[model samples]
Target: MEGLALILLYLAIPGLLFSALQRFLAGKKKSSSTAKFPGPEQYPVVGRVHDLDRFGMWLKFKEWADKYGPIYQTRMLNQPFIIVSDEKIAEELLVKRGHIYSGRPQIRSLIKHKDGPAYSALMDRHDIWKTQRKWCHAAMAEAYKHHFYGHVEMEMKRYLGLLLLDPARFLDYTREYCGRVMSRLAWDEATQGKANGESADQTLHCMSVSGPITNTMTPLWYLPAFANPWYNFEVKRESEQRAWWLNNLRLAKDRYRRGELPNDTWAYRYFEQIQREGNETLEQAEDQEIFASCMIGFLNLVGVVTISGPLKFFLMAMGLHPEWQKKCQDEIDRVCGDEMPTMANFADLPTVRACLKETVRWRSGVPLGVPHQAERDDEYRGVHIEKGTIILACEWSINRVPEKYPDGDNFRPERYLEPGWPTYQEPLTRYPNFREGHSMHTFGWGRRTCLGQNIVDDEMFVFGAATLWAFNSGPKTCPRTGKVIPIDTTATNAHVILEPSPYQMEFKVRSPERGKKVLENYHSVLGKLKL
Candidate 1:
């Protein structure tokens, strides 16, 4: 019995030693890899979690960038995040080495049912994401070739008339116009002149309620279902949204079958592509998969607010800096000459284009870009980045880089017009073209960049040109004091997307002839649309 006990003790001693050695080696490797990076001091376990604030987090990120240099690391719980403030670094890592960095982190609040279809662009880099992205690009390309500009023109005219009729609701009209145009392109349901307000409300609610909560660097999401009310709410919200989207999908499919939907509608183009391919190269051929892919058009309803934010900024800039507005109006008048602005006139109106570019740069909608996840272990400039690290490109900081944009806090379209500025290009006639990739970082970088960028450019140019041509926006005067109310450029940080805090401005027609022309164009389009 004594000999047997001695033999067992010897075996257990070696096993314990081996496990201890493995843990020591792992700790050494982790320490060595992360030692070179600069960041705020981390606390044990919590690891900078307390530093996160729901509001002005991007500002805090920028402050960190100023302190820690362009690239730095921050940890929350066990997750490591790399915050990138320089565009060059972003291009190198996210664009040049995109294959390794194009993955999306798992957003706990946005998780769909275990068996439900997922948003394609939001999904991590995989077979499903690839297939759905291909379908979306194909459908968008087809729609662009057919009826994209026509829809934008019609909607802009309608929006201008609405603005003239009720300038007090300009922001509301902006959102409605965006929603209507997207709805028309997505499902051809906007000819009835009603915006998809419900979808817009759903998107806003989801973003407002879940965005701030999930964006934090805590492990609140890991709480058990019994203890997590947000988790339960999100589950129910996602289920309802799924039903709403699926119902819309069914209605669109039914309309397509009845030949009621136009060939140019996104639904028609998507369905046609599916039929044409006939599963030859398709992997996800199930109804849910098709719905998920086709729903990119519906998902673009999120752009309604995103685009409206920039347009509101444009209005604010116009009111605050009337000189720039006058410059744009002069350019538009020279280019279009009393006629409504169109894509054909885009090249001749560089000032208008520059204003649009500057507005987005001044107040980016998605300040902290959607986080990207590292797919595999990699090294950049001797800094080790492990797999599953979250990469955040602080776009607000990137746009404000002093070297690229001088006086970045102020609104300045001249940056893109003058040769001294980093953003400027030669040949003044066509320098600041939005569609030619002039504002790349504003949308995003690499494969996960916003798919609706081209549409955004087109919509903004036409809407901006027409607005500047028709109205002169300025700060409203207080009736009691007869003083101009200052337009606060401060933005709200309720969600990931940033919008200017509620402000008032007065938009007046530049001339009665312009006002008459706006009404004429609106009535003419209204008649044709009714038919």
Candidate 2:
């Protein structure tokens, strides 16, 4: 009797009916929300979730922007989202009303609040965010400019020498250059002067690899199932790495305890500021917290924005259009003659700067700039956008708008040379590069705009100017095919920050004499800046 009853319950007809009924009811509830926020006209509970996979989200976004004007609403996984493609709408929602929208969507599985583990700064826009930003800003202030510049010049010469030695592996060479720059900025130590190649390579490898991996992971967490299991696991991994960095920082703190910590770049500045404020003791979490913040801030600018994205674009541009490379080198030759484009040349070399701007616009690594969520319910052109709606500013669309640019899609640098045309259709009132406008959506909008914008602009200038001055870049011919296949600039799509597709190109030194001249000039001017 007991066995028969167990079998009936295990394969119960009533149990199966109940399960089906529960699913049907849940589906009905989801279907009910679709009627209110109609997104692309979907069947019952299916909604527009499938459409995203069918048509790439960004491409679909482009189509939606065209059909529904600058601001439109959609639903994904039953979550209502707002897309704002127009710059004006972005300014109004993300900038003017930033208080409500500045908060980030929580991805709890990825951004766990652990006992002692430190998380990335970009993960939270809270009290620590303010503290970290303020400390970094003052640390890299005007006074330290010369101190850091002096170090940078030495590294620049070293980098130029390395590039000349091995013209191939320009990506690796550029990474090496950026690593040295960032290390100097962070610790006031030259990467080349470091004891062994092992430590330096470890640092470089971390910087290079972390960019794409984190970029990939941050977005993946939004997808269900895939990002769920790894939540605590990732937090533990991050904590372990943070522990290592904290140990190094603790040594610095210990040295400071004994009054032996030498004043240098960022660390020096931070300590000086703390001393000046007359606050000796810090929070228990200060060392670990600061290290984590600095790592994120530094990498957000140097590893991801400054180096990976722009360096890849610079390489691709040089690879695709070798003429631009020659033109830049020629300009360098004419402007500096035997001297390299240093801090002084930066002002004078309008063409080279223009070329950098062109590269940023021509192959913008950030296609759909970071999405801004509306803080409160808003109305735009009769469209009622509810709060929590994610808004996208069409950066790629803005760059490729035909009305704003004559040959919008072409990679021509000369358009900028025309009087009153350096910025294409961008209004003169707004910043043209990196952070643009009252509500420029590239760096981001309002208080959330990238904190490291200045650092990025400077680093990109250095990397671009240095590369164009030194080598020629483009595709290599396959002996069998005898056809020149250019680097694919269209390999950009968003995860968090869009990245260039992996492609091969050759880097060759134009002239050893010219390279020596640039190095000499770099050292001479760099010594004066002290930065």
Q: Which model scores highest in TM-score?
A: 1
After superposition on all C-alphas, the RMSD of every candidate to the true structure, in Å, is 8.6, 8.0
Off by over 4 Å in 2: 1-39, 42-46, 53-56, 113-125, 141-148, 189-229, 254-262, 279-304, 420-440, 479-482, 492-494, 515-531
Clashing pairs in 1: none
Q: What is the per-residue lDDT of model 1 for residues 1-531, given as tens digits with 9 covering 90 to 100?
A: 325423433444455356446644765776576545799997654467567765667888899999999999987655678999998899999999999999877665666411224466567776666766677777666666643848889888888898899999987787677777777777776742234554555445444422525434224555578955657877886666566555566677778777787877776776677678784333454575546633654455655766777777778888888899889888888878999998788778888888889988887877887778899888898887888888999988998999988899888999998878888986766768655645578777899887776677788888899999889999999999999988768656345666677788998988999999999988989864532
Give the Cα error of residue 164 in candidate 1, in Å: 1.0
Q: What does candidate 2's lDDT look like per residue over 155-228, in tens digits?
A: 66666666666656556666556656655455443342222122333322232212223222233333345533
Cα lDDT of all candidates, in order? Answer: 0.73, 0.55
Q: What is candidate 1's CA lDDT for residue 103?
A: 85
Output candidate 1 Cα RMSD: 8.6
